[model samples]
Target: MADIEERRPRNKATTFLLVLAAAAFVVASALRLLGIDGTRHMVATTALVPYFTAAGVLLGAIALLARRWFVGTVTLLVALVLVAAVAPRAFPDARPIGVGQEVRVMAANLLVGKADAEVLVAAVRDHAVDVLALQELSPAMVVDLERAGLDEVLPHRVFLAEPGASGSGIASRYPLTARDLAGPSTLRQAGALVALPGADLEVVSVHPLPPVTPDGPEPWQRDMAGLPRPDLNGPYRVLAGDFNATLDHVGLRRLLNHGYVDAADQVGAGLDPTWPADAVWPPPVVIDHILVDDRCPVDTFQVVDIPGSDHRAIVSQFVVPAR
Candidate 1:
């Protein structure tokens, strides 16, 4: 027993380093809330930046525990700054910059054969959502929708080539001059832009292919790399369908780095769980999301459970007050 005790000699350096690492994590965690409004998702600028910093803390903490005292201390401090101070200042809070109009956008996955267009059409009409984005649009669903003739209902639409086996499309009640980010795309062609007449609000719809599987992290990283830099567009603010990477994903960190805010995280209400539609129970992950530009302050972000799809629909309402 005495020999065992000697074997476990107190290494003051290790002890101090561990404490520092833990404190760094605490600091990182706290910084996640700075200037955070807690009610937005499906939008990028709100939830992505701080979230990335939070993840870097976890990574840097791991590096700090590598038993090198000086290096550990420096790394831990850097992690703290990243999570706490840097993230908040780097990602500006979303403001109300839209023209005089309250826009409501709803995004849902019409799970191929399982989703009913009539039901979906009825819901869209009932809600009167200014913009409606749907994913997994099978060929039959398109035929069914055309048979029902929702073209009259939807004043404008931006439908590029079919989005994979499942399609991604946007239909708007307002006139929609379209823009497609086909090449400047990090993810698949789940992107399109809609211009509302006299509405001054540009809405960009997206459905980034999820970063699942372990083939290589780069695919995910590349998908997250070179995100929509609003600085490039210069106040050309808009909303994004986002398809938020899951809580466990590293891509969430990357999105945050690009200055995005998830409206769902802002609301402080319960989390909007909406993936694994084929699962047997509640849900194992929250994959689908909506992100908005910082200039558009959203009043509500709620989860609407639709029957046909595996994932629940996320609806966000924006009431941009005086800019």
Candidate 2:
């Protein structure tokens, strides 16, 4: 009887310890699902949402094995906290980035759909976007976009040679006398469109490969590093489009390290969430963005939705700061 009593306590202790460890895992799992840990790889991981979802399940299994109530609760809390930090960054900034000049640029991914084109074109006309970058555009769609009445508003333009991959295009209110656009190195389209916009600015619209896997981020990074990165002492520059990763992602973090500021965050109230346009179910992560050099200041930022595509349009109002 005494041996049984002693064994019972020891068994309970072992169970408690196992449960405690499982609880910690549960927390980690929850955090990952809530989209808490924004890493260079997280965007691609969105494709296998089940793997992330399984993390929570595995953690719960551990908690059940151990039966540690307090441990489980704490783990859950920790997981929830991590997600809370990331979830909030998804919105637009309630305040403007700078008080220098006001310019608006709109970027949308038109998934080769007529209805999306129609809706996005209407939004562009309504908002009077000053600068625009579009991705996943077909040759047919490009012709249609140019004909959609933005010609008078955004008369200046830059486009690429379609080497079979979906092309990227740019339109602007400022005059683009000439361009230097290089087509995609791999599957994604990336290029610089030189324009003489009032002064001297080197604006680039890039659509790096969507980070669908580890293989994706690498080539895009290599190509980006090779670009004629803006000169420090000279002109105002901007790189905007569907970069396919969030701010915490490595490539983006590197760009920020190189001094590119997020254009949307500059003039928004954290109200800019652009990718996965199902705002109702909202897998709507902020994959599309506008990033500008320090010389430009942002005035307003908003996300516009396209009818048939998965990404919303990124619209920003900003201009080159006084020298």
Candidate 3:
């Protein structure tokens, strides 16, 4: 009888934990369904839905082990629902092997002029990257890149090398024609048309303002909303850069709703984190992206390390779809 009484307290503690886990899952799902991540605090928590879902699953398993069948079953069901919602993005359709015209593309953030020019140039040359998109392109970095033989390798370019994080640029092996698709002054976005042998590609380097504070969320959301949609009827389209928003962000998710497919997500690499490369606490998230139109098939996607930058570069090989 004494042993049974002692077990009651432990069981109650386990049940309490399980209930909290279930509540977390419910709140996350409700926020996601309501599209309420516009605030800084909400956005941060919303971005961690996957982690919270995983926690729910863990708590459920513990409940099961403790023989609390009702709590275990309920929590597991909630976690499974969240998992199902994420599954499509977590494991998208795989690209067919040896199918279309291959084009290697890369996007890197310059950390507001801190990235090494020589290192950036080396990455372009070493990867034999066909198209390169860059954000935070300072005027001095442009000169340094040119001196480091970037022009000799890329040959074609369209750049707006402003002073800070608002700068953006694109360099290509093929001929390029600049386009006026960049939205307002705060967006710092740039676009270009690349002439390939069989098909032309429309590339954009995008950098939306980060939502770090309460006052900044609305502007960041506005900048993301102002990004131009891909002209599906025209040439193949590719948008790549440090977007300052992830798939978890409603703004970016709404942009993807316009029929664009993320290269990393298509290849099951979507969940890999890309920001704050050197951080140990608070974890990392994928704010950088290489989004391709549905017409383009992503062959492979990978993240490349760059020194002195907070973001890891995204490198992807896309198979140009048949016209």
| Best candidate according to TM-score | 3
Candidate 2 lDDT over residue span 1-323, tens digit each: 98999899887887676665655555444434554434334444443333333444455455555675565555556545544534455455444244444566788777653435557778877888767777766777766766776676788777653533357777777766344533344444444433443455556666776545456456665555543445688666777777776654556656767877787655434435666777545444566777777556666677776777778777777766544
Each model's lDDT: 0.55, 0.61, 0.83
* Residue 302 in candidate 1, Cα distance off native in Å: 1.9
Candidate 3 differs from the real structure by a C-alpha RMSD in angstroms, to one decimal, of 2.4
Q: Candidate 1: worst 10 consecutive residues by lDDT?
A: 36-45
lDDT of 3 by residue, 276-323 (tens): 888865778888999887767787888888888888998998888666
Off by over 4 Å in 3: 1-10, 87-92, 96-100
For model 3, how many clashes?
Answer: 0
Candidate 3 lDDT trough over 10 residues, lowest sum = 92-101
Residue runs of model 1 more than 4 Å from their true location after superposition: 1-99, 161-166, 182-190, 231-235, 242-244, 278-283, 320-323
